[model samples]
Target: MTAIPSAMRVIDVPKPGGPDALTLAERPVPAFGDDDVLIRVAAAGLNRADVLQRRGAYPSPPGAPPNPGLEAAGTVAAAGRNVREFKVGDRVCALLQGGGYSEYVAVNVGQVLPIPGSLDFIEAASLPETYFTVWSNLYEFGRLQRGETLLVHGGSSGIGISAIQLAKALGSTVFTTVGTDDKASFCEQLGATRAINYKTQDFVAEIAALTANKGVNVVLDMVGGSYVARNLQVLATEGRLVMIATQGGAKGEIDVLRIMQQRLVVTGSTLRTRAVEFKREMKQRLLQHVWPLIADGTLRPVVDKVFDLADAPAAHAHMESSTHKGKIILKVGG
Candidate 1:
């Protein structure tokens, strides 16, 4: 490796609103706690949260670097004193609370997962955030089961694709809603039982018809606006809706009567602000259960596009466009 520097190139929120707000700068390399590892980033995954962070809407967690990135694949360049699970030179990828859009980043050792031999850096970089989020919300929290029906919004998105594959592999009948015909086709290829074009089709009606009007057992919702009401309308008598984002708007008048009548459960979670122990547990569970599928090729990251580190703004622009399918990533090292 080149002589290590105290600082590295990073993209920042020079101000909010559009790709123009993202600017490249040399910033101090973050310090690692005894339990952390310093990774030489090979690829960084772009997420809606990154876009939200860039816009000043999703601020970095307290004390983290202002730089925006949520996940990365890399090699361990330095391991802190207490780190033992990995050593310098091990190939790894990590889920980050912030500061992933840099040449180097410090990550909790527990958050680092060994890159499966079957995956390249770009594919591995696309895994952490989306996979973890989907696993936690759809399976763990939502209690999705085999033989049940699942409805996913934004089906072409990283989370949506992952949920579809995971749910299918777990034996659930999955349905997805996409904005366009192209996205709808992509969702079907990922194993969605039926991919509905929300632009020209009514997802609720389609799902109801598909499921014989019995409704779906679970709904993985990211579009929040009026979707809150619609989600309840399509939910089975005793179903769950796991909301991960509010691309549709945060505040909306929900129908409490519908929720009660259907006995629906609605909940949301963001893993970034959770305690280290909670994240550690999630990492452990993922490695134990999800890693084998990734290694054996049953589950894989859906990477749509990659941009050079300097072109992070372009990557963010692609994510904001909402036209790209799967996770957008940044190639960090030369």
Candidate 2:
């Protein structure tokens, strides 16, 4: 095993602003606990939450590292005394509450999974955040069943593409909304029944027409604001509307009458603050159900671009531009 270092490089936000605010600094390596494993991070996945953190909008939860990465893939440098599922030197990816930006991070064993199949560290690095979000929201909360139709907004995003492929692989018909025709084509090739160009098409009308006026069974949305009413409108009777983010804006107006009249389920959740037991259970379920698909190449992560750890600012800029089709990652180590 490589001897763990006493200190490691980490990205820090000196003050909230644009990508320029991100800078590299040295910090003591995080310590591991009885149930924790210390990862020598190879790469870390970037998410919108990082952008929020950079702008001083989203603060890391108490006890989480102040820096902004949400997921990482790496080899274990050490394991806690109580950790048994993974040992030192195991290749793994983890869902993190925060601190993925550092060269070393300590994660509870339950939040970690063995890297599936032949995926290199870069691709494996992109999995946890998007996959966990998709499974927990789309399957656990939404109860999206086989043959059910799911409409995913932000279809070109990390979360969107992950939800699109997984739902489609599991037998659900998937429709997605994207900003560009290129993104639309990419999403369609990834198994979306159709990718609506939200800029040019009224998603509500398109969904209505596509479903022959019946509406979809679920709408997995990240954009909130006015999309709330529109998403409610796009749901069939007894359908579900799962909200995972408020990228458009936190406040959204929904039609109470429409929800009541259609007997619809409107729900939203944030995973970072959820209890460890919940994440543990989710990891087990993903291992049993989704890991095989990943191992066999039926499902895979889509990495749009990679930047060296020092270029986190450029990576964040790319993400904010909203031009990428999938996950953006930071390569932290060789």
Candidate 3:
């Protein structure tokens, strides 16, 4: 058996600020509980949430490490006494509550899954955070149905790509907004029916034209601020607006009369703060419904770039630039 190390290096934000605020620090390897497993991380996904946490806008949940990471993939180095689904030497990826930016992470079995198909650790690491979010917010909580039309803001984003592919594969039409024509083209190729260039084109007008003024069934918006009012404009009567992030700004004025008349539903959630049992259920659903799609090549992770563990600052900068499409990953052990 391979000997377990007592210490590990982790990316830490001793003081939250810009990308440069992130630093490498040494810490003792996390200990596992009865239902937990110790995973030797190969790669970790870099997310907008991590960026937010780095900026001091979002903090790690209570009981979670202050380091900023939400998902990782590698081999299970040790399984606890109550963990039967995984064992030492199993290849797996996990959705974490925080602290995935390390050589090892201790996570409950409920938040973990075997790596799907022939994917490498980098690809597996890219899956958990966004997939868990989209599946939960867009499908389950949003109650988006097949045959519905979805309007996704930030089409080139990780969440956008995942939502687009999922909606398209599940028999729905997808319209998305992107900043550049290149991003628009990329999204269209990835299955978005119409990728509106928000810089040149007014999304509200474009969506109205595209849907013939009927608007869409659901709008997955990350840009809150004024976009909220505009999103409500593009939503059809009884349309649902599911917000996952507020990159634009949080406060906004909405038309309550329009909401009452149209019966629009406004809702949002933060996946990092959800219960483990809920995540476990989402994990099972991913295994049952989404894993086959990945295995069969119907749906796949779109990794934009990979940075070494020591170069996390650069990775965060790249993500902040928002020029890349799909997921950004931090290569750890591998």
Q: Supply the TM-score for candidate 1.
A: 0.97
TM-score of model 2 vs. true structure: 0.99
TM-score for each model: 0.97, 0.99, 0.99
Rank by TM-score (best first):
2, 3, 1
Q: What is the C-alpha lDDT of each candidate?
A: 0.89, 0.94, 0.93
Model 2: CA > 4 A from native: none
lDDT per residue, candidate 2, 1-334, as tens digits?
A: 6788899999999899999999999999998999999999999999999999999999999999999899999999999999999988899999999999989999899999999999988999899988889999999999999989999999989899889989999999999999999999999999998999989999999999999999999999899998998999899999999999998888889889998999999998999999999999999989998989999999978999999999999999999898998899999997
Residue pair clashes in candidate 1: none
Output the better candidate (1/2) by lDDT: 2
Between candidates 1 and 3, which one is better according to lDDT? 3
The reply for model 3, stretches above 4 Å from the true place, is none
Per-residue accuracy of model 3 over 111-180 as CA lDDT, tens digit each = 9999999999999998998889988888887788899899999989989999999989988999999999
Counting clashing residue pairs in each candidate, in order, gives: 0, 0, 0
Q: Give per-residue CA lDDT, model 1, range 144-200, as digits (tens).
A: 998999999999999999889888988999999999999988899989989999989
What candidate 1 gets wrong by more than 4 Å, as runs, is 1-3
RMSD (CA, Å), each prediction: 1.2, 0.7, 0.8
- The residue pairs in collision within model 3 are none
